[model samples]
Target: MVDLKVKLGSLELQNPVMTASGTYGYGEEYEDFVDINRLGGIVVKGTTLHPRQGNDYPRMAETPMGMLNAVGLQNVGVDRFISEIYPRIKKYRTNILVNVSGSTVEEYVETAAKINALDHIPGIELNISCPNVKEGGMAFGTSCPSTIAVTAAVREVYNKHMMVKLSPNVTNIAEIALGVESAGADSVSLINTLLGMAIDVEQRRPVLSTITGGLSGAAVKPVALRMVWQVAQAVKIPVVGMGGISNAEDAIAFMLAGASAVQIGTANFIDPKVTEKVIAGIEDYLVRHNMTSVAELKGALQA
Candidate 1:
């Protein structure tokens, strides 16, 4: 029998197929279309110490093969998430990882501390890589110094597994990955949407409110795969690959590239059942390849 289980830091996922934050609400929203328990992990929407209204409308636009979005970081503050959302998802059989973000280091640490208090939540995905926001998001993720400081600060209070999400908008992504890994980050997930923009020629205006948004979908798969490969080779910790992953072949490709696991983002919007399908496809691929476990595929690239 093939084993699909994968480990991220101290958390053991049933499989590598997890729903990315923001794409999948608290896991309850897709209950009708997806079997939440079947997923390896569920990363809840990005949360801050306080609530955020997010950016203005016209936050999303369609590009050639991908989509651009500037959703800001709209989320019910951590308090509300714990009191309201937590109770609902705490019972899921899979690991429930909270995607934490903030405007400042203190806020990030404080938020991480709060999430640490939740006994049911096994881990937190630190999102210093959100491009839609003006303040904290990508700013912290792009700078190696800020990456080290914020992660180390949160490490003090957050006892559970902590995964740092790296932004694609950077000069040296691999360097940033190494910095976070050294700063007590248990793991790192990468290629958080690339910065992009769309324009309306006739209207003579930008498509999104922020004028620029994070590009995601099939268009980003190659870039995501390359970045994942680079960071995975550079860091000792596991790397969670994401960006434009839409099917099982894409997930497998990431695994082969060196990602210990992967997060399904925009694909969830297209097909809520995509996670289950990817899981099944992985199994089929394993069988066809005569592999016994998914772990064997990590960094298995022949070239």
Candidate 2:
């Protein structure tokens, strides 16, 4: 049998297929459609220290092969998540990774501290790439220094596995990846969402309220794969690759390119059971290829 189990720092994942934050809501939302336990882990929606109403109307828009979203980090805050959501989700038989966001360094630290106290949550994914907010959302993720600062700040407070989510809007993703790794990040997940825009030529205005939103879905697969490959090669820390991943083949390609594991995002919208399908597909591929372990495929690229 193919061993799909992998480790993201101290946290162990049963498989490499997981739902990307923001795209997967709280795991519970998709429990009826798919078996949540089959996933490697769940990265819940981006949570802030305080509840946020998110952006105004028209937060989502459809593009050619992907979707644009400016949800503005709409979440029920960490307090509510821990007090309410966490208790309910603890019953599920799967690792829980909290996706965290903040407008300031202090907020990130406090949120991490609060999550650190939780007994059920295993890890935290710092979403430094949310482009919807005005202050610290994508701002910290786009630059190397800011990424290091934010990651290191959270690292100091949270002792558990810390995965930094990177933005695809930067010129050099490897630089940011290295910065986070140097700052003691356990792992890194990338290509959050490409900064993109859509225009209503007839209406002479942008379709999304923010004018520009994060682009996700099949349209971003190639770009995200390249970034993941580059960052994985540059950093020693494990890379949790994501961006437009739709099927087992896409996940396999990411693994061979150097990702320790893969996260499924936009594809979930088209099919809620996408993660389960990808997991089975990966197992079939491994069996056909006569591979005993999925980890052997990591960084198996050729020139």
Candidate 3:
């Protein structure tokens, strides 16, 4: 059997496939469709210091090849996650990661600190893409300095595997990834939905409540692949790539581009069992290529 185990900092995933935060909800939601233990990890929905009701109605819109979302990180506060949600999901055999988000650096740090105490949680995907309320609504990950500051602050309080998820809406995502790496991020996940919007010509109004929202699906794959390649080359830590991976071929391309692992986002909405199919397909490709371990696919692109 081809070895599929991969590492993200000190955490060793049985395979390199994981479910994106918002797309997969808690592990229990997909338990009937997926074998949760067979996957590498499960990143729960975005969590914050306090519960958020999220953006108003019509916050999501469909485009040509993708979807736009301004979900605004609606979630139970970290306290509820720790006391209620954690107990339900901690039983999964795979790694359980929380995608932590906040509008302020202090909020991020406090939320992450709480997750750090959970013995079952091995790490957190620090979502620096959240809008920085204190800074007039600019995303923290869009600014290199702000990214480092928040990452470093949380790194101080949380000692587990801290994977900082990067925003694709920046001019220099690689630079931001490097900043987080320097700030003590154990690894980095990239290409969080590109900023996009749609309008209703008939109604003469924006398609979504928020004029613009994050875009994800097959359309973002090319961009996500390029950014993952760039950041993987720019940083020493592991890279977790996600943005539109729908199949094993796409997942393999990210690994060859430089991602040590990949997260399936929009595709989950299409097929709840997509993650299982990808894991199987990866092993099949390894066998066909006469490869022994999936790790060999990392940065294997001839280019």
Worst-scoring 10-residue span by lDDT in model 1:
129-138
Which candidate number would show the highest TM-score if scored against the true structure? 3
Models 1 onward score TM values of 0.97, 0.97, 0.99
lDDT scores of the candidates, listed in order: 0.91, 0.90, 0.94
Highest-scoring model, lDDT: 3
Give the deviation of candidate 2 from the true structure as CA RMSD: 1.6
lDDT by residue (1-303, candidate 1, tens digit) is 899999886899999999898899899999999889999999998999999999999899999888999998899899999898888788899899999988888889999999999999999999987432445345888888888888999999999999999998898899999999889999998878888999999999999999999999999999999999999889999999998899999999999999999999999888889999999999999999999999999999999
Q: What is the lDDT of candidate 3?
A: 0.94
Candidate 2 lDDT tens digits, 88-141: 999877888999888788888999999999888889999887432445345888
Which of candidates 2 and 3 reaches a greater lDDT?
3
Clashes within 3 Å, all models in order: 1, 0, 0
Residue pairs clashing, model 1 = 217-244
